[model samples]
Target chain A: ARPRVGYYFTGKTGSQVLTDKIKKLQVKDFQSIPVVVAENVSVYDAIVTMFLEDVGTLFVVDQGSILVGVLSRKDLLRTSIGKQELSTIPVNIIMTRMPNITMCEREDSLIDVAQKLIEKQIDALPVVKLTEKGIEVIGRITKTNMTKALVSLAIDGLV
Target chain B: ARPRVGYYFTGKTGSQVLTDKIKKLQVKDFQSIPVVVAENVSVYDAIVTMFLEDVGTLFVVDQGSILVGVLSRKDLLRTSIGKQELSTIPVNIIMTRMPNITMCEREDSLIDVAQKLIEKQIDALPVVKLTEKGIEVIGRITKTNMTKALVSLAIDGLV
Candidate 1:
């Protein structure tokens, strides 16, 4: 018979220990309530919503809050300062469309999500779950959230 | 005399080898020319600069390019949407001040810079070098840059 082993028993500062902790973390543990906007919303309204929500990124959802697209501050800033009028422009025109957006599920590992964020060079990801209808956005995982987790781990001397 | 040994002699995945390579990198190798703006510039002008530079964060510098403060897209968005007039308002009032800004030197480790970025919850860090005059803004290291490095390593099977 083989003996069962504990993961954390290795040296405290070992990278394996930190890697294990990150892998064990679920996206739901750190994801925040997603700030969403409908695709048809005017760019002006979208800007106001962004400022009001205090979030740099906004998830564009459908009538049932199903993920459709993603909009960022750069998108709005570029559109606003461009020749087009903000009042008449809809977010759908500037948003990164679906089937191209990178997403994560609630059960996704934190390490995997972090990799996606880095690889994609994006600020946030919609934490979604597959359903009978389609993908439903339940929460959001951002660089800030990952940073918070890392900082907490550091402060606790667990990293 | 101690026997000479190599760090990569152990049989590890190419990704692990790349991870080791990244851990040894310094901030200077990854930093890029910083996008900067004057403190007295109007908020509208700053937005234009950001758009032109294609950067979300702009380092606020004084005469001789001395580091003073930092400005982010969120800051501009909030200030512009507020009661204050963007045309008349200056960036100094809204920028994060000197004493509170997190900075790094060229000699700093990449891992340290990454930790600082995560810990401070900021998108970028002003990679500064101490000069006879004062701290000079040599370059900047952003999350996007770091992401690019990570992605490159991953592609090379070194992550």
Candidate 2:
């Protein structure tokens, strides 16, 4: 029965309430600003941008500013050890290209994104927005964001 | 007054129960196996080991099997871009040495470690054990683990 005068028993357990609160969390509420680079940029420049921005992941976009691929520190490290020159190699040749990219939207549930990260064993996910032109990279959601979410949940009653 | 039957009110709110459960989570419950490299190992070899082990962070230990330094993917990536040959440079030269390494114990609260990871802006932490010889790396806790913790918390009632 519905509560009357705010004094009725709700019958919901503590776990149920916690689950409700966690489920309500959206990617937009905890996502960080994204850092991107052009697809034509050299792998060397991409690494430099990664260092300057201090991000583990970088989204690769085309000249029209549409997300085309993704780059990770692991990908760069592997290519650096090879015989090819870092400056001569374009990031598009080595980047994880589209259709293989894992992405989420601002309105997606944080838990669903968290599960994708774990299942895919990836470091970060691009929070994207679909457009008439193409998909646009709007935000970034990494394990760091998930960790922050856990901390906030414990520190506060609701996230 | 306490109820004589099984209907006594505990007077704890849902958030209180959630907080208590989250606070009780320990590092040992979610940590992954630690990956370590010898201090004398070449940076190139260390990167190879990292890829083989498939971990973002690697602990560097001395001849006595004591934790001496920590190597991150960022460290190796930065060195890879330098003029120096990665095969010739010892990891100890590029690794973050002792007294600066952020670590946690097995019994430590997961929430506390999560805070350290965010505060230090690092990728992972070694779960250590103090012996007469030195600190032994027993486990590893990363943002991935924190993400897993969050997922578990939502999937199950308590984690």
C-alpha lDDT of residue B159 in model 2: 62
Q: Which stretches of candidate 1 lie over 4 Å from their true place?
A: A1-13, A157-159, B1-33, B38-45, B48-53, B79-121, B139-159
Provide the TM-score for each candidate, comma-separated: 0.70, 0.96
Error of 2 at B146 (Å): 0.3
**Candidate 1 local lDDT, A2-89, one digit each (tens):** 4363222233333443344445767888889999999899988999998788787999988877889999887777676566667798
**DockQ of every model listed?**
0.17, 0.85
Candidate 2 wrong stretches, greater than 4 Å? A1-7, B1-7
- Residues B1-159, candidate 2: write the lDDT tens digits: 785765444677788889888999999999999999999999999999999999999999988878999999999999999999989999999999979999999999999999999999998999999999989999999999999999998888666
Residue pairs with colliding backbones in model 2 are none
Docking quality class, candidate 2: high
Write down the worst ten-residue block by lDDT for model 2 chain A. Answer: A1-10
Residue lDDT tens for model 2, A6-52: 44456777888898888889999999999999999999999999999
